[model samples]
Target: MGCFEDLSDQELITAAKGGSDTCFGELVDRHTTTAYRVARSITGSHEEAEDVVQESFLRAFKNLDRFDGSKSTFKTWLLTITRNQSINIVSSFRRRALKFFSDHEEGEPELEFASNPLSQEPLDAETQLSLKRQYHTMDKALKKLPERQRTALLLRSQESLSYDEIATVMDISVSSVESLIFRARKKIIELVER
Candidate 1:
């Protein structure tokens, strides 16, 4: 089982499909952080992101038999599931909120971005303040992006997925992914410049 750590995602999936729960667990351990990041970027709440990750993994586990490695890598497939699940949860929440408040609604709920607390070096007060301002500005700009654009940008920038892989996860063409990311970056720059 210790050797499972050396196996690729395809190997892990094969072993998991062969009734090795440990292999599945190893897959979970390897991919959970990226899953959570993808989920968090969509849902904007830690709790909601956590829920999305859990649900996505459950669905992935159940549908493992349907996964074809030739079609997509496991990470791409899993992130697609995570993205779909996050969108569903967010849509459900919006529906319920609309039902609850009809006439006097103000605007969309404020989204909370995850902080980078893993930095090892301490920063001076001025530098820290400058970084905080930049992050806040970026977050505001990101929140303004349309869902598809935001998802595309995050997958490419944060997850470091290639355009082809992003297109696969997003069910769009490589050109479409390129266009989305281009427009997203353009919009963010415009927003920040303002």
Candidate 2:
């Protein structure tokens, strides 16, 4: 029943912490798919999403008593943990991969494409496959943004969290979140709608 949806998040948290396994499972069931989407978007891998969700719940359960209902909501807390874990895992993998390449290429000079000798029209490749590739490519480009803008965009767009909730999770001023998200949206719209 969507009756569970009718309950406030704090209500769910209390029920779950009061030894209601059903409530906790309900919470997980309600959120897991969305959590995985958030993780996958952050980490850019399905396997990492699976691992992040599993690890996030494990950590959350262990610290159940540490949760105080007053501050951040349960969803934000769980999502924050999941997102952080995914970013750490992805960043670590990138660092190791870069180091491997660096060690292997010690003697070779890096290669660069000299500015296209001919400035040909770059638009011809917007084929059917290219249309499908656009959003995914744009998401990675979003990661190239500054940290606060990226975080703000992901939470709002992927998790559907409100700006106040995002501000609390990010420990930033509400105005700052608003501004970051505004700038992020402008940049994404500029790229995607083009």
Candidate 3:
């Protein structure tokens, strides 16, 4: 039972690209959890997140030859795929939301967001139930926010991305990321407390 612990990201990547399946498997094992979190944050669905993670890895494998270690770290490159896939998954769900909205209107209850917005988290069962109800209200409050504000909150709060990472994902400057997060937090407090 040997470990691949001695290998560098580039070495592992090279081995995987050269058809060493174990190297690829090791990479998958190493990254799956992080990939899943990214997927879950964006899609707000565990099942969809699983699919996104799988698809992200597949896309990464297929494109491995094009990966240049100098331009971006391997982790960042793989995570880019994860983020993109999650975004696509969420976009599809948004389409479904629009379709449902079209089919039913004033009487249609707002769908409970799959992601709960608040929590110092790792809540107990009783707390989860209590917060789940509050989250429904919080979610509605969050919806009133402008698009960038909502996105900033989700990326920052749920995804736990740093400002630079957010800038990378949002294609914005770091200072803009800070402004977006601040505006979102202020709006959230205003809305939730109303």
> Which candidate wins on TM-score?
1
lDDT of 1: 0.86
Per-residue lDDT over 1-194 for candidate 2, one digit per residue giving the tens place of the 0 to 100 score: 23276677677778877877666777788778767767766765566678899888778777878987788778888887887888788779675787677764233222122233487534344343454475557766786676668778888986789989888777788999999999988887776666
Q: After superposition, how far is residue 159 of candidate 3 from its true place, in Å?
A: 5.8
Candidate 2 lDDT at 175 equals 96
Per-residue lDDT tens digits of candidate 1, residues 1-194?
Answer: 44357899999998889888889899899999899888877876677788899999999999999999999999999999999998888889674686578755344344334445697556666776777787667878898999889899988898899999999999999999999999999999898889
lDDT of 3 by residue, 1-194 (tens): 23387787778888888888788888888789777766655655567778899999999999999998876656667777887877776668675786677874334223333434475345467766777788768767776776556666776786576777777656778899899889988988987887
Q: CA shift at 30, candidate 1, in angstroms? A: 1.6
Off-target runs (Cα >4 Å) in candidate 2 are 1-7, 93-95, 98-134
Top candidate when judged by lDDT against the true structure: 1
- How many collisions per candidate? 0, 0, 0
- Give candidate 1 regions above 4 Å deviation: 1-3, 93-95, 98-132
For candidate 3, the per-residue lDDT at 126 reads: 71
lDDT (C-alpha) at residue 30 in model 2: 74
lDDT of 1 at 125: 68
lDDT of each: 0.86, 0.73, 0.73
